[model samples]
Target: MEIQKNLIQLGQSFKTKEEAITFCGEQLVSGGYVTPDYVPAMLERNSELSVYMGNFIAIPHGTDAAKKEVLKTGITIVQVPRGVNFGDEEAPKIATVLFGIAGVGSEHLDLIQKISIFCADVDNVVKLADATTADEIADLLNSVEV
Candidate 1:
């Protein structure tokens, strides 16, 4: 599936998980990707998907009725100065967070799989955590061939 560059920019600018989810939902709504009212539910779902891997990376995502109905498929990147706890026993600081929202019936599993592979690389996640701008993050993402 073709990655939506605009969605990546929307994700990169969020400072908090709540903000990230809200912004992603808003983008889905405005872009006709999802309904606006699905934001809260999406947040609730994201809370459960939060995972903090070592090296300052957090991936919080959910594919529930609200998210699946609204998002279709998109990715959002968020940077937190102090990082957030992902509910792990270690609860490591997640300096950078990425949300991958997939809607029902969307066949972008390849893109999602590629993103997962990219995030699994410690070096790439480290670089993403340190990215200073949305464009830089987007560029990094684009550099990865899905």
Candidate 2:
């Protein structure tokens, strides 16, 4: 999925994973991509399983049950230059970029796959994490080879 300029928030710093995820959910809700209920579902999904994808990134999305709450396909990217911890004391997982998604049907799967492949390269993730502008991040993602 190509990054939307308006959906991206650059230079963010969240205290907790929950707070960061909430911000992503709010972005989706405010963008008219999903219903308000979808926010709680995102939290629930994260609780059930961490959205932390490693390499300083996290992709938070609603549970399968919350699929019905989606109004349209959308994504929100939050760049945390300082990074946010997404793990416990036993293991520390600091995420510098958060990708919140609300997709219709199976569309999000393709997006997730693309993101996974793009992010698999630690250098690419660093570029995103260090990006200072939304347009820069968008261009990076849009220009990347799947």
Candidate 3:
């Protein structure tokens, strides 16, 4: 899975989706995957469009213009076991998993596909949400193939 090679923070507790977004975005930027501007770009884009990808997962990606900010293709996954609201009122929509992806060109499609495969099974998503540690979460994703 695309997430296997990227940074992962598990069992985190963020009071808001914005907090989670900022945390993960900064991580990606610091890791040299994306420019610092990409973080704010992602937040702005998310404000325009909901990133909730179903199954209690919110995937935040930079705007098309912000693509220039990406230096490498990678994903920073932040799992908040307590969950965070993503501008939704539905009870099932509070996302417990946050996936911040930096895609270079067509890499976005591949990255999306990888995430689709990773979340194809509800049980897998549930297992991922309930994972106790970053290592466990990484091992779970690393065990899957896109």
Which candidate wins on TM-score? 2
Model 3 misplaced stretches (Cα beyond 4 Å) = 1-6, 89-92
Q: Please give, for residues 12-124, the per-residue lDDT of candidate 1 as tens digits.
A: 44445576566656655666666666667667776665534445555444445554465465555555555555443464455455544545454445555676788788788
- Model with the higher lDDT, candidate 2 or 3: 2
All predictions: root-mean-square deviation over Cα? Answer: 3.7, 1.2, 2.0
Q: What is the lDDT, from 0 to 100, of the residue 51 in candidate 2? A: 93
Using all chains and alpha carbons, the TM-scores for the candidates as numbered come to 0.66, 0.95, 0.89
**Over all chains combined, what TM-score does candidate 3 have?**
0.89
Best by lDDT: 2
When sorted by TM-score, best at the front, the candidate numbers are 2, 3, 1
Q: After best superposition, candidate 2 residue 35: deviation in angstroms?
A: 0.7
Backbone clashes in model 2, listed as residue pairs: none
lDDT per residue, candidate 3, 2-109, as tens digits? 455448877789777788888889979877999999999889878888788888888888888899999998888888887888865655468888888888898977
Which scores better on lDDT, 1 or 2? 2
Error of 1 at 18 (Å): 4.6
Clash numbers, per candidate = 4, 0, 0
Worst 10 residues of 1 by lDDT: 8-17
